[model samples]
Target: MKRSVVVRLLAAGATAATAAAIGLTLQVPQAAAAVGGVTGYATQNGGTTGGAGGQTVQASTGTAIHAALCNRASSSTPIIIQVSGTINHGNTAKVSGSSCNTADGVIELKEISNVTILGVGSGAIFDQVGIHIRDSSNIIIQNVTVRNVKKSGSPTSNGGDAIGMESTVRRVWVDHVTLEASGGESEGYDGLFDMKNDVEYVTLSYSILRNSGRGGLIGSSETDTGSGYITFHHNLYTNIDSRTPLLRGGIAHIYNNHYVSLNESGINSRAGARAKVENNYFKNSKDVLGTFYTDAAGYWQASGNILDNVTWSSPGSDTNPAGPSMPSNTTVSIPYSYSLDAASCVPNVVAATAGANKGLQVSNGSCTPVSPTAGPSASPTRTAGPSPSASPTRSPSTSPTASPNPPSGTNLSLASGAGADGSSKADGTSYGNVRDGSLSTYWSPSGATGDISVKWGSNVTVARAVIREPSGTSGSIGSWQLINYDTGAVLKSGSGAGTITFTATSLKKITFRITSSSGAPKVAEFETYAS
Candidate 1:
């Protein structure tokens, strides 16, 4: 048979399955089958085309999945692994090779790239087993169910995370899957989906995460602030106590999701994290959006959301809720393109499209579920702007002194008074080099554009900054933004590197973000002064 004819047949089968799942009366052309694609932030960073144009394999056990990976030609080889049946601890074991890394009692996608795990047939269930992804990129996981994974009990796996990514992971799309736990930490279960330690450019779409103490988290802790650029859309979070999720630091665009029966809190953006929340439905939940359980606050930009029967707790020393009335405190700029379904129809849209064995139905961005082959409806792209109810407040600034040179003051970055972190560092470069006061020792991001920060343990007042390139390596830095990390506020933005003067404002951390660059930029010194 011709390849074109086969492709059409497969697409028709997918359409039929989708129609059946949604109870639509559509003419069937072929038998139903599973299909795959990427969306949201996963479509960025060179695009996550998992296993496209590669070989396809089938697996019914965890060991078989590892065998398929280990049998690949290279670590970067693209392969689609169609999974079915129950994958438990007994059927999972270590299967190691140069192209793959595996461990007993878990499905590990480690130190590899360009892979897809799609559930097929009746279903794919990882019962008491977990999927662990580390040091990998360009991956897709769709139409599967992972449940009852435990951290400190018999048959423990993946530290109790149904699906966890960490340690330099990038560009992962998890769609149309179900991740659930029996109970909370006391019940031996942990986060449903968790990302930490430099993970970036990820999306969780058309999925369900429920019945756990912790839904998930972006960064692991208060100081683990490197991860960012995540999108959570069209997912369902229910019966989770808190941390749905506790974002430590990063930028997350969350829209069109449904939250129900949140026992404690929902969407705990904290430790300098910024969340752009729009068009989501929160029903019978508590403290749906806020910085909670810590003194280190986070910021949010919210709009077009519906809160039904939701309640908020009173403010405390460590808890701040964005409720009783949802207001925008900061503006987050989303780089990618997306369509938002109306909040009024989110519950129905999510219910029909999310979870496994649902034939990969997706919202048309107009409150209707459609076959994946039909594609998402065209809608106006939205960047999180100021809400109509509130505008972002800026800190009081002091006028800069008239000086072509940097203002006469000590460089706050020096004298061991500050620390450094960033999105990613190139091989053989150090984040600390940017603040070490040495022209020869410099820092470069893994790519042309990234973020670097100079943070202090306590708040300090500064008004002037001088971003210096390595000697003889000028003009590498292009357009950039100076952001107050404490409040997710853009203080100064311009092109090139030179003397940058802003109002003297007290802040704990300041970031120099490179949006675009001509080449691999090198920062010899990031000097700050108080005038």
Candidate 2:
């Protein structure tokens, strides 16, 4: 049978009884079956290939899912468990084996690796049964629906997360699943999808997270800064109160997602978290991006996003909204390659391709839904350059230079006659702070990019400059230019804050121009050297 025909039959709710009556037994897909390829950051760290050449088994109950894991030949053995029917607490029990660790009431994927749990044959639904993963790697969960798992209610599972991962988890790709809740913490529900405790290199793609108080979070606390390198794309977030994943001290790529009716703050980036948000559509949301409910600020680099009827609240000591006019405050460099559907088509594309029971369909990056067999092509319909409606461009320097160690010389920036100035400064920050020689005090641009210069009463021959960032906030400065302000000539240009050597230029003034950044660039010290 053609793959498209099978997909159509499955999408039309074909039943096993009907297939049996028609003298056709439903066969599980083989190891090479194309459910969809891994995208985003999950493609890093040796890549997330889950059970590609492993034995495929059928599972209807949660216990069977546990048994499938326990029955594996070894803890690292690859296996794909095809789940169907409704999985609930009554049918779930603790299963023991040398290879698996499981508990009652939840689908626990613990201390195991190279596993894939996929929905097949009339669909798989985990009703009030959450999926928990811990201390594992290279796992994939796809085409399943988990709803109403609570943290504080009766028969709670997985700490109220529809899916939760922790304790050094890595390389998990969750795709085409529905994770939802009926209400907020008052109703005993918690996050839909969450990760913490050194979790890294994960991706949540083409999924639905809706009708919940909290969508998800990267780190569990403000100080839990170890987890990072996540991607959320082509997902639908609707009727969520907050956290659309509160990020803390990690780098996240959020793109091509559809957000609607966010009751409160969304994408709460805090505790030094940095996000690259692009090509998404937001409608009827409030405070869609910012740091909220915490004094510790987060940062974002936004572009190619369409915000329709979004509202922003007044900035407070603890609330900082990025909307009203969302601008890119940073520039994040993504390692992997992926295509993007236009922001205008994100709503339509996400609605058609996201969520379970959609035949595992995916986009061809031009708003066209294609069969999973076609897979994701590399033909990018859109480039990473800013959109037409994007914020005004900040031109970077033309000449690129290599970063080197700080030159051994006198610090010219701290001279008695030296003075500092900038194009603009953020609140509570002064341009003079960059030469103050204290890492505790720093200077930030009014927005993402600006210039700060150190001027001398007399001309001085400078050979190098060292750009130092504040502690705990490294890697904020992106593209920058070292210019002789007296001559308007760029002496050196590069990305990142470090020492750069240049020909000795005798000038009265020199400027360090930040043209791009991953977050608010905090220049603790911009030291000029005369070697």
Candidate 3:
């Protein structure tokens, strides 16, 4: 379909990966190896051990991304592209029939293999544009946000899905992303993320789907059952109307996902689709898991799911309750060799690590123990073959630095020493972001009870300690403490992320210990001004 879109060439420089020091990402250690056989989004399709390789370059804008993909299409050399800046498509149209075609505005990874696309810097947002991946393998997309793409009001392809894949796709992993919309197709929005037509072995983890009527789906139609073997774990689905996802005739392992604020139905599995729904947290939703509106029907084996404050729909002829029990139908065994965090801890883990730019701090969070279980088939279902690609980069987290000079004679406390009692997500940037100075960055302790403390080189006069969330952040600090490490005294304590004013005193160190929080408290800056 030809349409009016800005499918242009790119500029010179993009951004770097979020790993240490930026511009480089290494393979995950054995101890840190994740579920889906690979680590980081880059290896989603396939990792360095698979196919993607070559120099890692940064790109910004849809044009730059397209240029990078186009440049690498010939050699088939593995590549990692770190994208920065906001790529605004602005009602652009699709220009090619191939799913991976570069139609200018929307970034398409068509006919590519072993590639990792990461967002860098403050963020990389694809505003009003969708990402299409087709005939590709071993692809990873992380720390990116795609929103506001309208299917009806403007020019788009495949219904303006925030991220869509189809045709001979395999081993694609998407993590720590944010996909949102203001309305459904009637309001010009489609699926947050969708897959179809022979897609398999895909995973979505530690990401978010919000403010849309549709979340995602696999196997576009009942006959398109070739798309299966999908995995979803540790994601947040909120403010969405339906499709907690619509699975059709595929085997999906869905676990540890948080569902909230749904007005319509959720998880409509039908057309012979089967899911093993485990350890999920749901609140204020209706029929969170059941058969689709169609009659073909679906089945699930649910275990360890918390449906707190959720309302169940009446059991109609084709409806089935998805919560609080496991299905009596065929039980799907977990093919992965992995561990699980406790159901109560799912919300905490997801809140701390899901979405872009908070440091991909994946917390173990008090999980129950389990043994390695094999798949139904004796042999391995999938092993990223054909030599692994280069390891993708993780975002480099910068710790807080002491202000060079405090305004009006105040000595900004340089954290000569810093430590956290415990943290949920710890990919470098942890308690130190409080001193990092940039409001765009902040420190979020896993769960709510831990303390992030900063120590000075020597004793200094201190009067006030100020703490606040990043700009446009609504995370609330219910109650917190300002402690003097020298004397082990609580100089001040208060609720909310506002400034904590206390009498100026001499102290060597101060700590910000949070007692309670509404959402994960994001401390952008924890400043202590000298007396």
Candidate 4:
């Protein structure tokens, strides 16, 4: 048999051939089993043809294998041919082969279903995509690594996603596959993952997202309700070097993950949407673990999460001196509400003393036993208890100027010599320090007996009385006791005034109206001192 005989049979559409040269016969199985219309073709063959010495003749080749698979008679079965080597598209027709070659493109699945493309590690590298699934279903792309997919559209507009899901793609499962570098536009904005508009009922779990610019993972919602039943868990966000998004969204369940060395935030819920942040560990949350927005209007419920290095305004500075101010980046409006949950629920106080937190227990429309959260280290700093028997000092400085001026632009006159009508004046001595129509009046020790009082007339009752001692004198004083000279009941007896060492109890209006006395006593200031 001549070598030309074998080549002639291959060109004549024979499956396989046999050549006998120098009495040596070689037989070849020309047809490889084709499952459907699909057939196999390779650019190079390793001399599978057989015969002896000058009897050596090239037998039937792969060219005959291509014609058999391309011209299938049955429509029910498509040929499945494996390409051991690449076949160029330009030379495909002249060589009797399928166009599963050349870098231009390979394996185009057009409007077909139930196709599986398996790769042997590095064999899936394509000049274009290794596999393009368009308008198809029941498609499985398993155990393949597609490196560097090319782009068809503009990166700024509709370039491409690592895996593009159009308007109506359902029940698609992309598992255990690596979509390496493979740059395109539209979504995937330099990330390992990206999805947009109507990506409903989708899940990405147990995956590693790293070294992408748009972040580890990114997604957005077209409608206010947001898109997808998104679940992000058990993934490590490492070196996520993007302007934002270590993982971002509102309708997402973010839990059990570690976020390390992020630039802007560990996780950001855009200033517009409400989100639930729970049970996640954050190590260095530089400025904040998370920031909720008020301008865009959303609620944030933070529960059971470990936040280290989160910063808020200081309690000692004026700008944010009393902690974070209400109504920040987001606006919240409520109708006179309160909370019962103790973990982070506390009432906002008003009309209390400057440095005190109004009490939480309110009874009979009054605030009682007001207490603030513990200072410095969750423990209240010790305050000296009140001494029941001592008269108290009103002036924090305890300075006694013969004429202490009231704060400017007010009528706190202290020059009249008679105590107001109901004051407790001395029996025989004319003290002459009482002022009938003044706001703040003080009396010094005119005699050693040391008895004095203020008389506020019947028309108006004395609202409060604050007494102070002369500076540098540590003497003790008797309390300011009220007396009704007509009935002599001594309505309220002296308990003793605050001494040089004690401060007094603050008082509201103390009324004194006697039937026996004709007119009301008039007093503007309180008077008391030691013997």
Best by lDDT: 2
- Give lDDT tens digits, candidate 4, residues 125-225: 22223343333322333223333433443222112223443232222333223444432233244444454443323333223334333332323432333
Measured on C-alpha atoms, candidate 4 has an lDDT of: 0.29
Model 1 TM-score (2 dp) = 0.69
Off-target runs (Cα >4 Å) in candidate 3 are 1-52, 73-75, 90-100, 155-158, 323-326, 365-531
- lDDT against the true structure, each candidate: 0.81, 0.82, 0.65, 0.29
Highest TM-score: give the candidate number: 1
lDDT tens digits, residue span 348-391, model 2? 98999999899888888878887887667534555553353452
Worst 10 residues of 3 by lDDT: 1-10
How do the candidates rank by lDDT, highest first?
Answer: 2, 1, 3, 4
All candidates: TM-score? 0.69, 0.68, 0.60, 0.32
Predicted structure 3: lDDT: 0.65
Winner on TM-score (1 vs 4): 1
